[model samples]
Target: MPHSIPLIRAAAITPIRRWVEERGEDVGPFLARADLSWVPADDPALPVPLRSVVRLLVEISRAAGPDTPHRIVNGRGGFEIGLIGRAAFRGPTVRDGFARIARMMPAHCTHEIFTVALSGDGLHIRDGWAYDLGDDEALYLVQQYVASLIDMICSVAHPEAPRAERVEMVPHPEAGLNHLRPWLGDRLQPAPLRALDFLVGSDVAAQRFPKGAQERAREANGETGRRIASGASLADQVSALVAVMLPRTTPHLDRVAAAAGISGRTLRRALRQNGTSFSDVVERTRAQIAVDRVRNDTDVSLGSIAADLGYANQATLSRAVRRWTGQTPRSLRSGLKSRIEPGKPVSETRLSK
Candidate 1:
């Protein structure tokens, strides 16, 4: 019997698509082969099946060449950080950056974990997965994710900031050195370990960037952290799906269930066991999204916010906000206006009843 397939963030496979397109090869067929033809290629937060992603990589590697994985993750895009990653890569020191990435990654991707550890030798940034996938495909993902981390560090600091003493990944028979050597040089090595590690030097780890704290990145991190802390319950998953689909359309139970790779009845039962319902999840999701947009994004008008959250009109959104936060949308925005004036610390700005 096939074990349950794990859901990963849709952004996880974006680089592969971009790489294939850049090489003049059609990515549609590869996506179809992996049963991902229905996934919206642009939406990064939508959940996708991990098994399908692995199969898609395997098929692409078979056609493109042994170096496909390394070539695709050339560290040019630095997209792995997503919204939360902006704050993660902006930490005081390289060590703090690694620690922040490890903590915040769960909000962007599931069935995978990142760890940062300090040993006598050096600081280690590692990737571990919860799903059982083929070695070659798994190695492909590790290669991409590990390189993206280095790229994220370079994005905030200098290109030569992250000095890796050594890099290690699980050994694969088809893995080639031609492409990896140009990037990692002699530091890339094959090992029996299941995870990939980038062992960094002490000096590089402690090196700090010039730019101080950024308010936008901090707010993004805080919001994502609260969502991830809600746990991986069915309700939380449904809520996340609703949030992603809100701007597009009303995320019905069946549509969300299909995205989750389950039936609506099954999802309903699971949520019931967890003490929640579909309507409850949707309402809560809309309330939170409305508040966040109203409080932080001043450029977006109330009507636009209402439309994005699937509200029928501004009055409906105002009522929902009042019920959720004990304040109308205008009141919440007005409360935050003064705190956002020039020279006011963004950290002092808070939306309250």
Candidate 2:
């Protein structure tokens, strides 16, 4: 059985849409090309295909010409201030806000995980996810996400409180680096991982917002979190858990069942009721992760990706990639590279798996 990849909130792409529209570019064709009917303005919580959103970002980049990413970042109007944003905004201090954002990210987007850690004199905010995007798409997403994050922090915190000192992104060509430097500053360092570091000023952690704001935000976030959790089906929960676990090891059905506080039989019954199986979810997740790594993480070798995904070896992953994409691992990588280059027409790049 094959399971469809889960959809993400349409609100995630709101920034890109707004940027394009502000530039006098009609966003309709881009949305249509990404298989989206309309941009959901009324219901920001509405779900849309994640791949489509990725495709839209790539298309927008192509249309906006050189240094498009910088323009998009600078053009960001404001944060949407959803449940997570509200919780962060209501926090007593900038550090507290980062903590709230970290805690609430999983509830908002299951595919990606975020973490905040204190380094010597600064704080590091790391974004981790099983790669499920091509090179260009991944770069666009990371850039957009980091920019929005910094913008949100700056918007809520005191003007001088939380200043980003540096950002680390996956390595790219000189052209990409040139575009990134203006917004990210010359402090940008290309690395094998994705993260952004902020220089926590002395005033950040102790600065407090208006009284009662924290309580109100927390109450609202609690309700939103509960609604999200309650509405999620067992299979959805299992799939999210599997995604988190896949990077470390091949998750077993029994282990996943236990993690969900259900027996194996019960887990199987729940999945069957949801019209899926454990194996189907696992295969789909692995396939998605493999493709992402192959297309984005050019630094990681095939054997390393196979091991990360719990395959026996590179040969096994090669076979799996072929079955999933109707192309070999090498061919898929090559094709994506050719399709993602700057100046390439959007129609040449298909989002379909």
Candidate 3:
């Protein structure tokens, strides 16, 4: 069952409208288009179909300016945070690279929570949140858009280098992983569950972007401005965190409420009054993840994957999977094959600094 729409926000309206206008065929399911009555493009509230917009911006930024080797952040106010990484942390050290990422891209860059990790194999970045509660289309667009941005970064950073690295996210179920593998070739992860593995050498990891890039990426308004204009209400907070963080971790009542900076009791009462429950919402999300995982990857070993989820063993994981899909992992992956989509260059869009 689909989650019913909540009270739409004035802030989210413009992005919703732009999404419907530009790529609704691809981005329609999860996002609700904005009501024109709320705001027009003339208004600061006018949002673009941002996932698409950001992807396009990253693509342009990859090709923009001189080949000075800079990092681009998907900053707010209609533009990318171009090359602030090089300026922010000036060194060819993993610490500098990470500091650059931390300074520039906090979780919720463009309204989503993203985490970056350094695994032994590569730089593993995970993006998903139970917040940003639009619709499935908005979620899908955001996911795909992030993946493309990752791809653009790798292309510009490594160029034709074979052993450099690649970036990707866990994609939608219907579209398979073959496409990413083709573009990234040996660099791509073997599974849809592949995290953003930027396999770089110690030297590249230490290398920082150009000078002055960090300050340029810095937004003028501070976190206070973000809070004031955020348009998040007490109630919307619960759903928002659920939308973003839920994808990263299992959505427990306490966890969801905590993300909203609210009490679990208050969250339960709110959801109850609103005709839903935390458990119901979590189960729904889990169901979606289960189906997507099952339908998309034949190679994602269920037994070993039990650990990917917070399961002690396959039995615990299998129980939940069966409840959602009415099929065991063996049955689910039996006839499964992956999917792919044609790669297209996103349009050029530049924002004022």
Tell me the tens digit of each residue's lDDT in model 1 across 188-294: 78755767777877767776655543443544422344223223566776676566666765567776666555688887777777676677677666666778899
User: Which candidate has the top score in TM-score?
Assistant: 1
Candidate 3 deviant stretches above 4 angstroms: 1-100, 103-111, 120-122, 131-141, 151-168, 190-203, 218-353
Where does candidate 1 stray beyond 4 Å? 1-5, 75-81, 120-122, 176-179, 210-223, 226-353
| Model 1 worst lDDT window (10 residues) | 344-353
Please give the ranking of all candidate structures by lDDT, highest first, separated by commas. 1, 2, 3
CA RMSD, predictions in order: 9.8, 18.6, 22.2
Each candidate's TM vs. the true structure? 0.59, 0.57, 0.39
TM-score computed on alpha carbons, candidate 3: 0.39
Off by over 4 Å in 2: 1-4, 73-78, 160-162, 171-174, 194-223, 226-353
TM-score, cand. 2 vs. native: 0.57
Clashes of each: 0, 0, 28
Q: Give candidate 1's root-mean-square deviation (CA, Å).
A: 9.8
TM-score ranking from best candidate downward: 1, 2, 3
Report the error of model 3 at residue 36, Å: 7.7
C-alpha-based local distance difference test score of model 2: 0.59
